[model samples]
Structure formats: structure tokens, C-alpha cells
Target: MAKNDGKVIAQNKKANHDYFIEETFEAGLVLQGTEIKSIRAGRVNLKDSFATIRQGEAYINNMHISPYEQGNRFNHEPTRARKLLLHRKQIDKLIGESKQAGYSIVPLKVYIKNGFAKVLIGLGKGKKKYDKREDLKQKQAKRDMDRAIKDR
Candidate 1:
């Protein structure tokens, strides 16, 4: 898959290890005032964030955008359930896929594009323990091969 556009703020690296990402979509975020500033300063975390379609609308939860240091009492909450702007058809597709057993909507990464904060959401299926182990083994083997080639 291609990389996300613009300056990437945060990424959930564990998502790939814990689940198999079947599809990805770039969705805009509905951010408050200081939230956008925090995002521009790279103070966002997507580690435990997930997406859900509620009442036919997409929302992201557990994504943390640190409050701006200089903000007053109106600073946005650090971890709030933010709305994700997605097309109706895309939301429908995600709803259908996520309804299947062991499937979920995971937030993969956050980035800024055209001065807008965008999130990359993925449709992922839970991975078995053996699957994770196999992926680790494959990664280690690739690393070893690359090292061997370098030393040759």
C-alpha cells in the first residue's frame, strides 16, 4: 500500500502486528481549536485508537491530541471521541465489513493534508497468536538475509 500523504503526526505500529489490515481509507477529522495546533506540533498519539460507525456516522475514540500548552480554559480534551468525516458509501462499506466476526475498524495513522487533519482508518481482522509468531519469524529471517547480503 502507498504511504499516507502530508506530514504524518502519529502511527499505530501495533495495528499491523495485532490485526490484518484489509482496506484503508483517508478520513478527515473534526478537530477543535487547540487540537489542530497540537496535531501540527506532532503531539498526537494513535496507539489505542479505534474507529466505529455509530448511528450511520463515523467516530474515532482513544486518539489523544495533547492540549496546547498555551491554551486557556477552553482547551480541548486530550482524549475525546472525535468525529471522522467519511462518505456515506464508505461508511456503509465499513459497517458491512466490520460486522463480520473478528473484524474491526482500526485507526492506523494521523496526518495533516492541505492544513486539514486526516486519519487513515483500516478494516482489520484479528490475527491469531500463530499468525503473529509467523510474522515475527518472517521478519527475523528477512533481517538475517539482508545482513548476510551486506556482509558478503
Candidate 2:
């Protein structure tokens, strides 16, 4: 129906606090049977997950997908380097940008779109301590303003 319309499975909230995202791209995940079942069961974690381009392909590392409860010995590993399905142009752009100083590819969020798992990856640069502080201050100020308005 709408862009990115699906049930969100997991999110890496720390990525925003530690980096300033420059751009975002949606890529589909190449998951196994048990992995998909685990994801649909809400047994996935995006914490500390990141994206990387290698050999003209993209992969997501450190993502955890708990084994399906009913799965037998064929269960997938909890954390694995899974392939990411991205366009060649997109991968090339990500590769070029990631080669720059202080740039990284981070997984922002994961969701199921049209019965397929998709990950939202972001190109981000590390935020300086002062930048993070400023962001905190701005957020606090916005909250204060909203509270004041509500009281009026």
C-alpha cells in the first residue's frame, strides 16, 4: 500500500545516536526457511548489525535470528553473515561511499514487506561527541516546548 509498509521486526536504535545518517536504502534479505520463520515469530535482533559490500555484493553481519522453536537440526545459526539483495548500482554507490573516511553502512531497521524480509540500511558518518550533545539538547528543548504548549 505505502512505501515501507510492513510490520517492523527490529531496529538498531543506537545507530542514530552514534552516527549522522546521510542516506538510506531498502534491500531485501536472503533468508533461510528457519530464519524466516524466526523473523516472523519476532525472534530477531538488529542490535549491532551492519551492512557491508564485498565482491560486488552486499551482506548483513552480526544480525541474530533465533532458531525456530519447532525447527530441528536444520535450524539456522543465531548470528550469521546473510546476503542482501540490492541492485548493482546501489551496491556500487554504497561501495564508493563507504570507502570514504568515517563512513559506514548500518542497518537502521528490519521489516517484512510483502512476505519478504527487508532491511533498511543507512550510509552514516560518525557523530562527534559535541554533535551528539547538541542533538540531545535540541531534543530536550523540543520536548520542553511541546510540554509548554500542552499546558497552555
Q: lDDT of candidate 1?
A: 0.92
Alpha-carbon TM-score of each model against the true structure: 0.97, 0.96
| Local distance difference test, candidate 2 | 0.90
Residue pairs in collision within model 1 = none
Top lDDT prediction, candidate number: 1
lDDT of 2 by residue, 36-101 (tens): 988998988888888888789999999999999999998888998999998888899899999999
Q: What is the lDDT of residue 18 in candidate 2?
A: 95
Number of clashing pairs per prediction, in order: 0, 0
Q: Stretches of candidate 1 above 4 Å error?
A: 1-3
lDDT of 1 by residue, 1-152 (tens): 33576888898999999999999999999988899999999999988888888999999999989999999999999999999998898999999999999999999888988889899999999999999999999999999999999999
Q: How far is candidate 1 from the true structure (C-alpha RMSD, Å)?
A: 1.1
Weakest ten-residue segment in model 1 by summed lDDT: 1-10
